[model samples]
Each structure stands twice: as structure tokens, then as C-alpha cells.
Target: MRTSRDAPTRRIRAAVVGTGAIAAGSHLPALAALAAEGGLEVVAAVDVDTGAVQRFCADGGVPHGYTDLGRMLAEQRPDLVCICTPPTLHREQTVAALRAGAWVWCEKPPVPSLADFDAVEAEEGQEDDGGPYASIVFQHRFGSGARHVRRLIADGALGRPLVAHCQTTWYRDAAYYAVPWRGRWDTEGGGPAMGHGIHQTDLLLDLLGPWSEVRAMAGRLVHDVQTEDVSTALVRFGGGALATVVNSVLSPDEVSRIRIDCERATVELTHLYGHGNDNWRITPAPGVPAGEAAAWRDFGPDVPSSHLAQLRELVASMRAGQRPRSSGADGRTSLELVTALYKSAFTDTTVRAGDIGPGDPFYTALHGGAPGWAPAPATYEEASA
Candidate 1:
């Protein structure tokens, strides 16, 4: 085999938990690409459903299949594990993998609550240990457009950000919630706010730094789900920027959009789920130069936002013996924002950073331990047809 001056790193052993939609659609494909390039091997697959595991392993070319996560962890002893399960299962599966001496790549909504998320983060070891770190898949922040915009802000091209708006308005009929874990507070955390819109909102938070406070409201408007199908919030950033956030699963012409008004220009990104350069636009403030406006839209290389982009970075970080981007701490920012939004919405009051800590009811449950809204009477066929 051809080799570089430095010895090539061994292929990292990897396992996957949950043989579901996200695993098939995103994570599995990304892992397969990495495996093909000789960075890692998909050593094991685990799921509660035996049939699902069998099919996933066969289809994905994973070497071993197991029904029990513990068994897979022990037998395969993978260096990395992908927790592609539901939000509720993420904490348990991640902690187990960490304890088993594997770094974890977890899907978004890493845990249902801040209390649980902190617990999982605690399982990660210090940097010197070459540890058992966990990286959350917040892929939207990895795209070239986002990277270019971030550089613009850093270079004072956009000037101080003044105001912003974020929207994740998508449609999901009652049939979509037929899946057992789809909309319940206990299993899925919150509704569109937690599950669907989280991607855009996380990207919003990624661009704007820390937030100071939020006032929000949520309602179980259309779907019969236990959580809110639509919600809105007004946020105050520590940097003095104010943003309005809206999340809904009711719009037919679904779109994820975020617009930021800065001193020099107005920057906007619009797309559903993921984005490429075409989704971004910049309008300069009246006094700003046209050249700067043109430069804003000229993101050099094209990199679309996707799981594969993040996975490549995660694998590279592992090889460099560094904690990956969107590590536990980085992910907690978005989770904390979610928790605070729930606290503000449910209570009809302002919620600040550090307000939803250990003893706060919102820390453990998004609904503050209150009983979730009972699912309204609705049938999947009736809604779908």
C-alpha cells in the first residue's frame, strides 16, 4: 500500500444504533463513504427490532448485526458509535457507548431535556484521554455559505448585527405522527420547536452568539400530537441583537429561512432541511460598497449542508486527536436554547440563560413535569386522504 511520511492512521472501528429513517437516509450513507475511503469500517449494527437490524446490516454492508446495544459494544468494541436513534434513546445509547470507550456521533435533539443532556455530556472524558467525546450532527453550520457569512461578520464586513428572524415552517399531517415517538413530550421532547425547526434555530444560534433572554408561546394548533405543532419566540442576544423565531408544521409551501439585519447588509438564507450556495442572499445597506455586497454572495467553494460534511470533519478531528466541532459543549448551546424556549412558552414569561438549571422543573422536562396535551381524536387515513 502507498503510504505518506507519517504512518497512516488505522481504520476506526464503528457501530450504529437504530436502523431507522435517519440512519438509512443520512448517517448510513455518510458512514459508507468514509468506509470506502479507508477511514473507518461499519463493524456492527444494533436495533430493538431484529428484522430491522438484519435488513440494515445487509443493505448497508455492516459486518455484524445485533439486537442488543450492549452486546454489540462489548463484542465489536468499536472506536466510534453512531447514535441514530430517537431523542429519548440518545442519552442512554450515548452514555453506554462512551463508557465502552467509543466516541459518539449523535443525531440532533441529542437528548429530550437539558438535565439528560448534561448527564450524557458528563460521561465524556477529558481531552488528554483521547476520549469518548460526543459530536452532535448540526450540519447546517458546516456549509460554505454559512462559513463565508461567519467570516464576513468576523471581519466587520456585516458590522454589528441588529435584528434577525428565523422561520422553519413545514407541513406534517396527522399521518406523520402515526409513528409512536413522533410528537409526545416524553418521547420527542417538544413538537416542531424541538424536532423540526431545531435545525434552523440551531443554525441561527450558531451565527448569533449567546442569547440573553426569550419570551415565547407554543400551541397544539393543528396536529393531534401531544406537543405544539406551532410556536414562536422573541429572543434577545447578549450582543444586543433581537431575533424573532417561528416554528410550525402547518405551512404547505414549507421553507426554512433566517434573515439577519446588520449595520452593513441584510443577510438571508432560505431552504428546507439543507442548503447550498443558491439558498443564500445578501443585500447591502445603502451606504455600503457594491463590491462588498458582491463579495458576500461569492462563497468560493461549494459545500452543501449535509450529514456527510459533518461526518468528514468528525473523522478528521478524531484522527487529529481533537474533540470534533459540535462537541457536547457546542451542542448544549442549542439544547439550552430549546429548553429555555419551552420554559418561556409554557410559563408565559421571560426565560433567561442559566434559568433552566438543575433544580428547575424545565431542566428535566420541557413541559415542566405537567401532563402533556392529550392527542386529539384524528385518524391517519382521514388526514392523509
Candidate 2:
């Protein structure tokens, strides 16, 4: 791996923080693929646990390992940093990377709250200038299926998107929440709505555009965890479309789905974790020509939504010196939607897109001062015990 001093411009220096399952399972593999293509070099890995960091770096063939993120950033000065740390660390790590002049690709629930997200945003370079920007991992918005649907909706081929339903219902038992950060508000952010459902919800927002308001309900239906195990919301989009959202961890029939009822056709995606063109179906309204509907089904080659898909786009953006998707306003919009969902559920009032900001309590935390709503997460020691 050549350094920027001698390497071609397309081959960037990259690092990973947090040697957790996500870093190992998703981020590292994506980086490896990109590295094989000479797009970027995986230079270093960082973690709180020295042993874990060493194992991660050694097993992944990353050249350097450090226990401190600051030390790694200072030493390597990577051009891109993939942050797979827990939610609590996202804002700080992203800010640090951006401050170090590295572009950031942080995992979902980007930060615990809108304020933290905004704070990370403040560290970014201006749009016209070369970045040092922070991008969030919302990979569901990529792949050919999502792109096809988004283009159809945007071009009015799907006609006006009148109504939609988004669901992220996957089963998780007590053992799943055994991790210290898994069920905590202060750590993992919030339950399925923030940690799990944010993927599908972000894709929903990406396809449907800005949301006008949300009225939601959330509860701890099954798990003894501090956060809600289930949540539902009625969201109104700025374009006058309405969507019903259901996020849960108690479903036996596991699925992640988004169905939109448009004037000309009804488009739906049904899949578990990630989706491909095969998981998508488009049905034209009665009397609409089957030929026109066939054209709508042309999603081209299948590209399942994955870390690699979004990572490829990010690397391309880095090469072109352009802002990538799931960054800046796009990334913040998803976090804001999740925040408003929580606030609306807790307050039992409709919350708008701009309702939560610097002064708003929800802007700072998902709990948002709602009476008796603060979750007390178990300490790491207790969780491990």
C-alpha cells in the first residue's frame, strides 16, 4: 500500500476504529474489497482492548493497530476513517477524524441525538471545498433496487406516492441484549427504532423525501431492556404522502419491508437484513399498460444493499472530491427522523422535522425529559457478569 506521497490519487489511506462485530463483519471486508481494487489502503485499526485491536488488525491484515483512536489518527493521518464504534462514541470519533482532515464513515444511529449529529456536522469542510466530511452508514439507500424505485418515484413514473408502510421487525432475545450497549439509551441510542429500524427508515426517507410530521407510539413490549422493544409511527411527508412505520424486535416472522402505494403503480420491497432487485416488486394500476410496467422493473443488474455498495460510492466521491450520500444534510435528516419518532412517541404529540433543535431536549437525547422515560443501562461489568 503506497502512501499519498507516491500512490495514485484514487488509492486513499483508511483506518477503522472499534474492532467490534460490525467492524470485523462489515467494514473490514468492504475495505478489503476496495483495497484489492486499489481504491484505498486499510492502514490501521483501533480499539479500547489492546488484544482485540491486535487480533482484528492481524486477522484482517491491517498493518497497524492502536488502542487509542487519537493515537491512531495522529500517527496514520488516514484519508478515510470507518467508525464502527458504539453509538455513544460516534460523535466524538467522527469529529476527531474530521478535525484530523479525514473523511468519516460512521455507523448508524450516527450519534445519540440530533445535537451530537449537528456538532459532528460543524466539523465538516464547506461543500465547495474538499472534504473532511462525516458520512453515516445507511447502506440500505444504495443498491440497484433502491435506486430504481427512487428514480421512478422522482420521475413520476410511480406517480404520486400517496401512502407507504415501512417495517423493521426482527426477533432478538435476552441474550442478544446481553451486550452492555445493546439496550441502553445513553449507549446504543434507543431500541429498535434507533439502532435497528433506522436503516429501513432512512431508505424510506430517501425515497419519499422530507417528512413533515410524525406521531408515534413506543413500548417495552418483551425485553426487560431499558429501551423500547417495539415502536410504531404515522409519518406525513412534505409531499403530502403518509407512511406508517413499525419497528420491533419481538416478531416471530422476521422481515424488513417497505411498501409504497403510488398512483400509477405500487412498489414494495420485502427482505430480511438487506435487499436486492429480486426482493422488489412493482405492480401497475389497473388498466396501465403491462409494457410500461415492464420498463419500471428494469433495475439493471442486481446490487444487494451492503457496506461494500455504499463504500464504493464513498470512495468514488473521495476520488471526485464530492460529497457522498448519507452525509451532511442527508445523514442528519435520518437522525432527525429517528429523534422526532421518539419524541412524538414519548410526548404523544405530533413532531415536525425541525421541531427538535439545539434548545429542544430531544435534540440532545432520545429520552428528551419525557416523564419517567430515562433508561438505566447496566454497567459493562454487570452486563458481562
lDDT of each: 0.86, 0.89
Stretches of candidate 1 exceeding 4 Å from the true structure:
1-8, 370-385
- Among these predictions, the greatest TM-score belongs to 2
lDDT for 252 (candidate 2) = 91
lDDT of 1 by residue, 1-385 (tens): 1111122388888888999999989999989998999888899999999999999999998889999999898889888899988888989999998888788999988789989988988998777755568988899999788888888876788999999999999999878999998888778888888898888888888898889999998888778777888999999999999999999999999999999999989999998989999899999989877786787879988999999889888877777667787887788888888888888887778999888888888888888865454334469988988
Quality of model 1 by C-alpha lDDT: 0.86
Q: In candidate 2, what are the lDDT values of residues 181-262, reduced to their tens digit?
A: 7888889889999999999999999999999999999998789887899999999999999999999999999999999999
Candidate 2 RMSD computed on C-alpha atoms after optimal superposition onto the true structure: 3.2
